[model samples]
Target: MRFSISSDRLKEALSKVSAVVPSKTTLPILQDILFELKGNALYLTATDLEISVRMTIEPVDGEEDGAGAIPEDKLTSVVKALPEGLLLKFESLDSNRVLITTNKGGEYKMSIEPADSFPAIPESIGETAGFGVVISGGVLKEIIENTVFATSKEELRPATMGVLFQFKGDEFIAVATDGYRLVKIARRGVVNLKGGADFSGVIVPAKTLQIIAKSIEDEETCEIMINEKHIQFSTERITIISRLIDEKYPNYESVIPYENNKELVVERDLFLSTVKRVSIFANSTTNQIKFKLDPSGFVEVSAEDVDFGGSAKERLDCAYNSEPMEIAFNAKFITDILGHIDSEKVLFKFGSPTRAAIVQPYEDSEDREMLMLVMPMRLNA
Candidate 1:
């Protein structure tokens, strides 16, 4: 089999698909990328079993329809050295060797496994059904950045590794948390799919979604096709497929307390900045920070490390509507959740000192559709 394509176009396509190649591959074939050449288009594919991304590029000229697997690392290295606009040709001169010669007067021959030896990808698409969800690339990135940080890094609870995508009426919500803090964002006017595995509450691994989100950053809208076990994101030139986390996500609704007796409205930036500053003195093991609020409309933030004489306290004017209350929370959880709150003013809803506290945007307007829940820490005070 022999095929020739422009090095520039080939490299661009390979750059996108090669992300799926594993950094530490168990199987040698998993480290290579499958290249398929058709009449005028070239298909590039990479997979680590958990996720697969495929991209297509059209060459300036189509030589022969052929397919092969090339060592991704070596192939990328070789292509990067070739001059722009130079043509690179791939021909199976031997069963185990492929020759790559460029128009730029450089020659390189590399040993490679045959394309036929590559493991089979689920290319059939399995009678999949898709949704016509339309979300701006900016919106998608914003939600991911705000919530993905809260996803648990530990693998013991698989559901915590993913962001939950749920559809309710006209609202499309994406939520993620690591048990200490939770973020829920609702995007109205996003399409809700039917006729397929409507992946509601389906935990999509945060890592996989981040990769797919980056691939389609330039497109205004993207389609998500879902089957029983896999989810696919299709762009005009790229397709990313990822396995779904089968475990059931925790009932997040229950975790969010509705009747929090205390409420404080504060400047978002000031509150977040204070948390960052006070957290520096928090105990290393617990990272516990305290908030003292009174009906007087001001709050004192403080933290202390008894072992080292570390303590900090700050005061800020706030809008308090209920009786005085004090609460203790993990500084990291507070900072992590605060980073995602995008509003000039934010509302802190609190109940008893031991109960969870809810943080939300100041107003119920549709502009900022997010609600965060932060579990409080057991405190001595």
Candidate 2:
């Protein structure tokens, strides 16, 4: 392929698709990115079999319409090392090689493989009869950020290793759990379904959601297409296709308790800081921290490491009127659930020391509702 593109533009395009390029793969072709120059646009694609990313850069000076595959690391390294505003020219050379020359007379040559050797890109599902929606990129990013962290990393239970997405009417819900903690975000009127189609539940791998969150601008619009086996997220210039987790998600609703009436409201930042500090003295194996709540408007956070004889405690003012109770939890889990809360004050509802505690923002928006559940640990006598 022969084309001239600005170094910055080329670098941006390569960076977007490089995430999918496998670092270690048995198939050598998966290490390279396919570059196709046609008309005035250049297409860059990379895939690791499970997930694929394709990006398009337009208005490049196309000298000849051609395609080739080049090592992603080599091309990205060369472009990133060059000056910012220099225009780079790419040309196919003899003997299965590609030559890159900068406007300032810098030149680099790298081996290239025939484009046909690369794996076939997945076909777009936009036009097919499937569930499709147009969603704001900001909303999508928020949903992914709030829940992706809670996804399980265990390979045994593949269903819990990804976020669950459900669509009904105009409401969209995303849920993720790792057995110890779960986060569920529900939003209404945020996504516009094409043809008013709805899908029940689809587990999306956490890695895919993370890539989509970083690939698109917050203010842009994202087009999502979903079928039985795959899901696609597309922006104006970038497209990502990922295989859906085929396993059925567990019955999540049955675990969420609705009778958690004992409420304790505390400043989110203050409570989070206390938990982090107290966690330093928690047992290495358990990482357990205790919450001593009193009806007198205060909660004491404490942790102890009996093996090493380390202990710490702190008292924080809160709004609690229920009977006095002591609950314990994994300090790490509490910190993670607290980090995602966006409100000044956080509300915690407890049914008992053994029941799962519910955490949420003190005030929820009319269009968005977020609820996080963390299973408590048994307090030591």
Candidate 3:
């Protein structure tokens, strides 16, 4: 079997799916990319059992139709090493190896595995059990970017390690939390549910969304098909399929405090920079930063490290309408929340020094609403 494809095109398709390839796994075949020629297109697939990505590349020329599994790293390295736009000829040396020769006389051989040995990607959610929605690539990108960082890294609570996608009526909500902090973004009229149906919140692993964020471009809309067990996202050239987390996500609404009466409006950049600087003096273990709001329209941010005898404090101008209050929070958590805000000013609503606070973008978008929560730490008495 033989075919010809451009070096650049091959590299691009390979790079997109390369993230799914396991660097070291007991399953050696999972390290290879299944390459198959169907008509004028070459199909490439890579997976690590839980998530799989398959991409199609249109070839420049072909002599025969065949399929084989090429070691991803070897194939990617060789193609990338060649000059871009160079046409490369591929010929099967048998079922176990492939010979790759560049049009300019460069050559390399890679060991191949029978394509059949690659594990089968899960079939799309069955029509009877699954439903589908269409959302823009840009919206999906923003949703993942805003929420992924808040997912829990510890495996003890598997549900919090993924982002929750809740679809109901004409609204879609994406949420992620690590117990200490939570980020939630909701969009209206973004989801077109199949058969006018609704889905309870579904937990999708953060790793899967990370791959989608990289693979999906600025296409107008991507179709998302989901069911109780599996979910798939598809565009023109790429499709991603992964198993949904089976555990139930926590009822996040119940924990969101309803009595946040104190509101503080401050410049986002100024507050972020102050937190960044004061955090340097915070205890490395606690990363605690204190917020002191006074009736004089002044807010003080401070941190102290008793172990190293280091401390820092700074006061900034703000619009404080609520009563005087002081609160303690993890500096890193506050900084991260502020980083995701796109507005010039941020509104922080606090219930008390001991209750969780809500942060919102002061200037709003017409279509989307974002809310963030950070738990307060105990103040040093």
In lDDT terms, which candidate is top?
Answer: 2
Model 3 lDDT per residue over 1-381, tens place: 689988888888888989899999999999999988877788889999999998878744767889998998888877777887898898999889899999888889889998789898854554744678888999899899999999999999999999999887777899999999999899877667676677777899999999999999976578888877888998888889998999989999998886788889999999999999999999999999999998689999999999999999999999998788989999999999999999999999999898999999998888899999999999987
RMSD versus native structure for model 2: 1.2
| Candidate 2 TM-score versus the reference | 0.97
Q: Is candidate 1 or candidate 2 better by lDDT?
A: 2
Candidate 3 regions exceeding 4 Å error are: 126-129
Q: After superposition, how far is residue 327 of candidate 2 from its true place, in Å?
A: 0.6
Q: What is the C-alpha lDDT of each candidate?
A: 0.81, 0.91, 0.89
- List candidate 1 segments past 4 Å from native: 1-12, 77-93, 99-108, 124-126, 130-134, 193-200, 363-368
Q: Give the TM-scores of the predictions, in the order they appear.
A: 0.87, 0.97, 0.96
lDDT of 2 by residue, 81-179 (tens): 888899899999963899999989999999999989999987586665378778899999999999999999999999999999998778899999999
TM-score top scorer: 2
lDDT of 1 by residue, 63-178 (tens): 77777788899999888777788888777777778888787767788877778788888763537744435556666777778778889988999899999877665566888989
- TM-score leaderboard ranking: 2, 3, 1
